[model samples]
Target: MMRIAIVGAGIVGLAAAHALLDKGHQVTLVDPGNNQQRPTDGNAGWIAHMDVMPLASPKAWRNLPRWMMDPLGPLTIRPAYLPALTPWLLRFVLASSPARIKSSIAALRAINAEALPSWKALLTTLSLNGHLREKGILSVWRDRNHFLRAEDIITRQKNFGIPLEVLQPEDLKQIEPALHSVEAAVLYPEGCHVSDPALLAADLLRLALERGAVLVSAKALAVEPANDAVHIRTDGAVKDVTADRVLISSGVWSRALAKQLGDNIPLDTERGYNATYAKGAFGLNRPVMFEGEGFVASNLDTGDRVGGAVEFAGTQAPPNHERTSAMITRLKRFLPHLDENQPAKRWMGFRPSIPDSLPVIGQADKDKRIVYAFGHGHYGLTQAAITSRLITEMMEGKPGSLDLTPFSAQRF
Candidate 1:
């Protein structure tokens, strides 16, 4: 059995550790404890399999000015970080080209199609199937103009065989009475939701531990691949470790570590903000996406967690909680009865994003001993299981079922 070391304890890393252990590998997880700012802790928790479109689409590029003009709009970039962000933005523009978006959609769909089934299998293996709620999610648009503008993409998604239902005004009211009058609502019946993503992540880590995988609390500083083993340097009680192989799944932080290993991946951070309120705060049945708002509100068993937005800020920048406040303020228009008085927990997390929206998931330096599997962006929660399966397949020297060309570490 191979001795594998995984960096980052987020959903991707933890799921990978569990998969590696089940394959009889000795696994060690290196993470810097669980911080609220970690993406795994504060994502929208929707297994959005139909989210195959890349964020850098032609439409998104056209709406850039309007989105930027509105400081609290769906997408924003800090003025101070604009210089550092220009390169990524330029690449994003390139990726928005028709050809690139088509390829990106193909790549995303390959893994996304397996998302729900993969999660089901993983949860079943862990005897935690109940953790996954297959309740459908809604994408609602209040303005007829917005819905009309979105028709092209909606039609494209339907053409791709994604099960989608266009609900009428009266139909939406009967389905989700909590939502105020909406012009149109599209239902994705295949989407799944997890009541508490953090709790589920803890359970996955616990299972890995029970299976003899070791958890090292530390921040990985560097990754050095030698002839025999890969060396991992970190800051914690355990300073360093050497393993037969290493998988870098540390989200946005993976960029530096990958660069250290001769891969200049253009991985940047999409600083996302979120707020969790007491149960029954807005009383929704399932996750609801505000069609044009670039955010979603989900009714979790624990409470109502509303969040989403892409802020092009570097990882080190302090979060602006004002973004979360803005979402709540806008959401109040839809759910006028939304109780802001309820106790709420606010959070901001960095989502590791690539220009094309496809994750980097393959061997690094043409070496099977070193692999890279970060950059799932906002869909990390949805694709984590499938990614783990592919990672395990690669580590086992078996040909992966899906083509790795699109997700290759060398793609960039």
Candidate 2:
């Protein structure tokens, strides 16, 4: 059996490890451990299969000035990083072209279409199906103009075969009584979410361990080709390791390693912030997306987690907790009755993002021994299982069901 080493212990890496183990390969998962800023733990936990639109759309450009003026806005880019981000920013602008967006949407849909089935199979195998809730998600828009503007994207999604149910104010009230300021809502019945993302991740890791996959607590520093094998250097207890193959799924930290392997991927981290209120603090039944506000409020097993916000700061910058506080403020304004007295938990994490909002998932070099599966952007939680499945298929010398051309590292 080939020994495969995967870098990163987040959802994607763990899922890939489990898939590789199931294929009877020897798997070792490497990570720094104590993942205080893991997106898998801090994300909104929504399995948003219908969220196929790239973030670099023309509409987003129109809102850029407003975001720049408001430091606490939903999306912001630090001034200090702007100069260094010029090239990537230009590519991001180009990726917003109609043709690129259409191609990206189609590519996203191809993988996201299998979200439910893949999650079901993975969860059942891990015996953690109880963590998932398939009650669907609600997207609410407060402004009439915003609601009308969303219709165009909704129509496009419908044309792409996504099922959406547009709801009036009354329909929204019937579904979620806590919502008061919404002009309209849209329901995607196929959507699902994890009740406890942290617990689910732990369970996935537990299952991988039970299946004989080793977990190494070390930071992967670099990777190199060593004849038919791949050599990986680490920073902690296990200084180095050599394996038959390596999969780089290290989230925002993946770009550096990819560069070392002859592929310069333009990857940036989307600094995301979140806050969780005590359990029973908000009696919301399912995840609710505040469309214009760019946040999602969901009731998880632990509490009600409000997550969303994009900061184009590099990975090393100290997190500005004000972002989390801003989300809480917006949540309070949305639901006036939410008890402010309860203790709320706050967190910040980085999401690996590519200019086109598509993940890089294929062979990294000409040798094909080094593979990459990172940069899922905000949809990593939704795409993790299918990504693992595709990686497994590729590793087994079989073509994946979905087209990998859009996700290839060479695309950049």
TM-score of 1: 0.97
Tens-digit lDDT string for candidate 2 (187-246): 988778998878888888888998998888998998978876888899978888889989
Candidate 1 residue-wise lDDT, 84-128, digit = tens? 989898998889888999999899889998988888888999998
Off by over 4 Å in 1: none
User: Model 2 Cα displacement at 170 (Å)?
Assistant: 2.1
lDDT of 1 at 160: 84
Least well predicted 10-residue stretch by lDDT in candidate 1: 58-67
Clashes within 3 Å, all models in order: 0, 0
Quote the lDDT for 304 in model 1: 91
Candidate 2 TM-score, true structure as reference: 0.97
Q: Which candidate is the best by lDDT?
A: 1
Cα-lDDT of candidate 2 = 0.87
